[model samples]
Target chain A: MKVIVIGGDGYCGWATALHLSNQGYDVGILDNLSRRYWDSKLGVDTLTPIAPIQKRIKRWQELTGKTIDLFVGDITDYSFLSQTLRQFEPEAIVHFGEQRSAPYSMIDREHAVFTQVNNVVGTLNILYAMKEDFPEAHLVKLGTMGEYGTPNIDIEEGYITIEHNGRKDTLPYPKQPGSFYHLSKVHDSHNIHFACKIWGLRATDLNQGVVYGVLTEETGMDEMLINRLDYDGVFGTALNRFCIQAAIGHPLTVYGKGGQTRGFLDIRDTVRCIDIAIKNPAEEGKFRVFNQFTELFSIKDLAEMVQKAGQAIGLKVEIDNLDNPRVELDEHYFNAKNTKLLDLGLQPHYLSDSLLDSLLNFAEKYKGRVDKEQILPTVSWHRK
Target chain B: MKVIVIGGDGYCGWATALHLSNQGYDVGILDNLSRRYWDSKLGVDTLTPIAPIQKRIKRWQELTGKTIDLFVGDITDYSFLSQTLRQFEPEAIVHFGEQRSAPYSMIDREHAVFTQVNNVVGTLNILYAMKEDFPEAHLVKLGTMGEYGTPNIDIEEGYITIEHNGRKDTLPYPKQPGSFYHLSKVHDSHNIHFACKIWGLRATDLNQGVVYGVLTEETGMDEMLINRLDYDGVFGTALNRFCIQAAIGHPLTVYGKGGQTRGFLDIRDTVRCIDIAIKNPAEEGKFRVFNQFTELFSIKDLAEMVQKAGQAIGLKVEIDNLDNPRVELDEHYFNAKNTKLLDLGLQPHYLSDSLLDSLLNFAEKYKGRVDKEQILPTVSWHRK
Candidate 1:
């Protein structure tokens, strides 16, 4: 079956491309290398300096005898997106194209506008293309845990069946995201849901959390297949930042009292979840949603976990409680039920000591490239 | 007190401008005349062909001796919006600036894209400008009743407190709008809510219903002060369309079983709601919402009312149930609470027999201008 990944250069996108192609599906990748440009702008490169998209696809073909087509373009260009959909007629389309950083969105007015436009317009274009050309294709979109924020109750996958005032109905979970980027995702989800209702198109929205680790089967053969290891404040994930902090002797920065907790999964597991979603598409007119994370951890718990993990590798990692740059609850109740992905046979890899060691080893090789200035929070939610 | 009204040329916008200005406030209108162009494109001038913005402002100045400045530009233009915000530095901003037609949104791909971009980007520009220039400005934006399609239970103003699995939190209701234009409103509301949380910029999103009638104080002057009233499908409200159908001896086009009930108020009451919302500004960091309508009526009931009222005014009317163009629950439950505005001292003018008679009488004067082609459903939600 033909498969096209819209944002096939990011952390999870690259891995999915390689794995799907290796599994004998016709796979193609489309991206603008926006995250790379963002990293370059911030003077932060991924840890191993992986080869570009062409080289990555070429190396994957050489190693696994599987060819993955690659194209560099903005999917927000609706005509281009429509042409791609019409040409490929893929059985499934994986959408990961969006501005995915909260702090980057909070940086300035330009970044904020860019985030809103890129995230929303990109999703709209993809949906428009699907409706125009490949209406039968299952669209598996990557949503986020941030859309739910820190509500006092347990978060259901993407919906909650409520029985209020003696009437029962299943409704999508009410969202209250924390940042512009997250808010845009909320918008995309709602728009897609509306499309599904109106057009009877098939779609899968995986509300995944903070993804960590970067090992795909293709990574084992060639370094090009290894996922991006962005370790800067703007481009990096929580775990990636913590690892770099430990390596560079910078404090493992914890915001406020550090009781803010969230669900997370390995990058590999994200690919696995997408694979499962593609294999089992939702019914036409039905919006299937899965809470795609395995476990949850607070910031303090994660920082201390990294600190201990670093100590095991002969690196003393100090901790610091910085004034919280973001305006969020330091301590709150958060219990989201991510049972859907698990039920879909996601054998999740928890954030173990071994995984931390592997991450550190990757960072240690590029210790010289770790710019300490990029480790601090450059964007604040509160305007001072 | 100073107030800047975005989309100030709209029905509610103009009415609010006149109402607020009469209440002794410095009011300036910022509009791009997108609605006027939409009216032109649909080949239906507002049933009452009112004067243009400049002429209306001139007339308001001449008659009431009240000077309300006019800034003619799209709110989507961030620079223009920000400059206007800075110049006015108004304590409150009435943001009625959005593409509000459901049938127009469903017309085609081009219309959908236009509605999404115009509505969302316009709201985003307004929000960012508020954050950058005037954080203290209370933004009163126009949301819609369609945002809460046909839910099973009672709908609160802007939020509902849900007790889920032993935990309770108030959330903006799980919006499931049925149209691209309404979907845009849902997305923009999320943006406004997020902006309020991050920037502490107060905003009131008035989730109003279809506004009918044209009898505000300033509109009493002449054609210049007379508010625009569209009676065509593209820009017309259901009641306006029914009224026009009565005037032209055409069928009142009701979709499907015509059991789709919704809250509705008068143009005068819409103006009243905005003035009340401005008087009771939302606190910083609060997303104040009010369901600004008085009574509810199904589509069939509205058509019957118009037919009966028009018969009293010596006009024949027919009620025709055509194929439903939109994908919505035709016969479903709709009970929305609108006590917030009433509590804010809005004595709602419910849809009465005399008011319906008055509406029919008003339409008879413009009986020659009613175009029969503009009265039917010109858009469909079918993807095929």
Candidate 2:
């Protein structure tokens, strides 16, 4: 089957591309390579000197004897994306192309505007392209767990059947994302769902949590195939940041009271979830949603897990509670339903000592590149 | 109190501006007059030849001795909007600054993109300007009833309390707007709600239905104060189109089965709802929402009402069920909760014979200008 991966560069995107390609699918990666420019702007690089997409693809081809085509373009540009989609005619499109950094979105107006525009416009273009050109294709869009926010009640997968005033209507659970970045994801969900209903387009929104333990089985083979581990404030995920901090013997920086709990998944499970979604596409006019997470841990718990793992590997690690920068409920209720992925045969990789050790070992190799300055929170959620 | 009405040159915007200014508030209107450009582009003008904003403001001043400050600027420009907000320090802001028509959005790719960027960016600028300058101000934004595309169950106001699998949570109702324009509103609601929560800004989102009446209490005083009554295929509201067709002795063009039921209200009630929202400010850190409408009617029912009212006024009006240009459910059930605004004291003007006669009389004056071609549907919602 033909498959196109939008944003095929970030942590989960690259891994997803390689995994699908390894599985003998005609996989293609579409990315603007803007993340590298953003990393440059912030004066921070990934933990390792990440290879270019060409190099990574070449390495994957050599390792797996498979070819994954590459389309370096912006999804927000409809003409470009439309032409690309028309030519490719993929049966499935995995959309991961979006600005996914909370700190960067809060940095300045330009970043905030860019985040909103890039994420929203890109999604719009994709929906329009599919509706106009390839109506039969399945769209597997990556939504974030943050879209659900920290509600006072247990969160269902993508939707919850609401009973109000003796009447009932299932709603996409009320979303209150933490940052503008997360809010953009919420917008993506809204737009995609609307488009699906209006045009009978199929969509699967995987509301995944912050993924760590970078690299799927395919990515783990070649060093170049390994996921791009961005440890900077702008492009890094929480678990990766924690591991890098622990590996460098720097204090694990936990924001505020560190009671902010969140669901998390390994990079492997993210790919598995995507692959499952591709295999089990939603019906036309249906927007299938899955809260793509496996485990839950507070900031304190994750930091301690990293600390313990680092100590086991003979690295001195301390815990530091920094001022909470983002305006969010530090302590709130968070129980999300994630049965859809499991029902689709996803055997989740739990965060155990071995998982922590694997990430620490991986982080140790890139300890010298950790930018301590970027580790500290720079943008406050409440501009007050 | 200094109040700013953004997009105060469009149909509802100008009516709202005149309504608020007449209420003795220091009101200012900020608009780029893009709607006129769009109207000109479509080779159609409003049913009534509306005066320019400057002249309208002048006439408003002449009649009531209440001058409305006019800023011919786009709210999409953050610098311009921020500066305006800082200078005005508005206590309340009524945001009608969006491309309000659905068919216009579905016309083609260009229209779709323009609508998305114009609406979303304009909303973002309003939010940022409020955050940067008038943080204490209340924002009354206009969302559409189309945002909640017909679902299987009864619709709640803005949120629904859900009980799923022995657990319960209140979530924003799942929005599945029919057109790109409506989808943009859903996205804006999410983004604006996030802003309100994060910045502790007060905002009220009025999810209103189609507005019909052309005469506002303020507009009735002078021709210059007349809100633009668009009868063109692209920009015309359903009722206005039917009125123009009736006045010109043409068939009332209905789409599909004409059973597309929706909630609707008068232009006066729309203005009143805005007034109520402005009077009752949302709490800081609260993104309050209210269903803003008075009554519901199916397309068939509305057509019959228009036809009957036309006969009562001595005009021969026939109902024509043209091929459904729009891709929506022609037959569906719609039961929406709109008690919030009624409780807030909105005395609605029902579609009585006298009221219909008033509309017929008003349309009679502009009967010569009605192009029969512009009264029918042109844009197909089905993507090519």
Candidate 3:
């Protein structure tokens, strides 16, 4: 099987690309390298030092004897995307190529507009390209768990059967996304669903939870092939940020009441989940969705867990409750169904099982690279 | 009250601006005049001869001695839009400025991308401007009923309360829009809702149905003030197209089985709905929605009505069922609740009462301006 990873230079994309290559599938990486550019623009670096894309791919080829093809371009450019797709002709396209930071989007109106236009137009171009050229290719899109936004009802897998006023129909689940970036993902889901209905295209939307840890099997094989670990307030997730804060002896900044709950998964499980999704594709003209997460935790729970793990490793960890920068319910009912991926033969990995070895130890190793200024939230949801 | 009517140079916008001006409100017309440019690009003309924006406003001032200020700029340009808003300082902003044609959006990838980016980004700019400068201003945005495609269950206003898994919540309605144009409106609705929640800005989303006829009381005052009537395939809707075909002795083309039902209202009622919404503003931080249509009709029913009205006026009329250029259900359940606007003091004019005077007579009076080549559908939902 042939697969193309769209944002192969970023964190999850890099890990997933290597996993696919190591599994002996033909794999190609298509990225514009904007993730690195954004880091430079924001004056922040990943906690772990990472090699350039070419050097990383070369090191992977040297160690594992696997060649991962590379196509560097923007997906918003339809001609470039269509040409790349034609050149690589993959059976599955894993799209992880959007501007995926909610804080980055809420920084200002310019960032908000750029995030939405870039993400929405990029996904739309791919849909049109698939409709025109490769109708048989399966689109494995990366949506976020944030799209559901803590609704009172249990979030089903992408849709729910609503019984309204003596009638029932299974419709796309209602979305109340918090930020412009998450709203862009919601927009992409709607556009992809429409394309499937009208043009007979197949798609699998993986509404993924917050990803933690820095090392996958392929990335950990050699030091030169290490994955990027973001610790900044803008691009970093809660658990990863907490792990880094504990390592550097900085207080874990818990926003608001620290009761905000969300689903989470490890990096190893993320790569494996992508692999499982590619192996079993959706039927032609079907738009399938899966809630891809293993466990659930609130912000305070994860901070306390990190504190305990750090104390055992001879480091004093402190937890600080700060004002919330986002406009969201600090305490709400959030029961989301994630049974579809598990039914497809995915063995999950838990955070407690790998906290010391995979997360805390790695953060301790890179304590010198931590930028303290980027530890606290800088972008407020409120308008200036 | 002071109000600014965005896209006030176009068909519905033109009539709406004049109506508000005649009602003793301080009105400002902000338009980029892209509607005229698009018609010239497509090599089509409106059935009614309309003057330039300046000439029309000038004529209105001469006839009624009411000064309507003009601001000629695009809403997508943030700096220009902000400057215009600062100069006008409007208490209400009536946003009808969008690429509002479904067929135009389905022409190709370029058209689809253009439609979504133009509409979504333009609305995003407005929300941000309101948040930064005019949080007290009410946004009367024009959304489409097509955002809710024909569903098995009845369509509510903009949201529905669902009972699922022993829990209940009122969430934004699940949208299944058919065209890129309609999907853009759905994106705008989500963005506006988020803005209202976070910034305490007020907005009213009018999920309007199809609008027919050409004359409002204000637009019919003078020849130069006549509102433009589109009869081309890209911009002309079903009922309006049938009226023009009946006047020109051409076959009234009904797509497919013509059983596709939809909500509709008169052009006269459109102006009144805007007036009513402006009079009763939504509360601050509230994202209010109203289904702004009075009645429902199928395609065949509209064509038959046009035929009867035309034959009674001594004109030859015929109906032809052609293959549908768009992909949609030929027959489906389309019961939608539209009592919100009527409850707010809207006296709707039925199509049966105004078919002869408003629509058919206008088509007959301007039959010489109709372009025969522009009568058939040129865009297909299926990709080439």
Each model's total of backbone clashes: 0, 3, 0
Model 3, TM vs. native = 0.99
- Across A1-384, the per-residue lDDT of candidate 1 in tens digits comes to 999998888888888877777778899998988988988787777766778888888877777778777777888887787877777778899999888899999888778778977888888788778788778889999899999999988899898888778887888899989988898888889889988888888999988899888776667566656677877777777887898889888888888999999998888788888888988899998888888889999989999999999998999899999999898999999999987777878798888999999888878877887777777788888855
B56-151 per-residue lDDT for model 3 (tens digits): 999999999999999999999999999999999999999999999999999889999999999999999999989888999999999999999998
lDDT of 2 at B84: 81
lDDT tens digits by residue: candidate 3, A263-313: 999989999999999999999889999999998899999999998888888
By TM-score, the better pick of 1 and 2 is: 1
lDDT of 2 by residue, B1-384 (tens): 888998898889998888888887899999999889888888888889899889998888888889888888888788888888877778999998888889998887778777878898888888888888788889999998888888778888888766666666676787768888997898788888888877888899999998898998888887777877877778887787788789988888888889998888899888888888888889997888888878888988888988999998788999998999887889986899998888878898876777777888889998887877777778987654
Ranked by TM-score, top first: 3, 1, 2
Interface RMSD of 2: 2.2
lDDT of 2: 0.85
Checking candidate 1 for backbone clashes, the offending pairs are none
The collision pairs in model 3 are none
Score each candidate by Cα lDDT.
Answer: 0.85, 0.85, 0.93
Candidate 2 docking DockQ = 0.56
Q: Which candidate leads in DockQ?
A: 3
What's model 3's lDDT at A151? 96
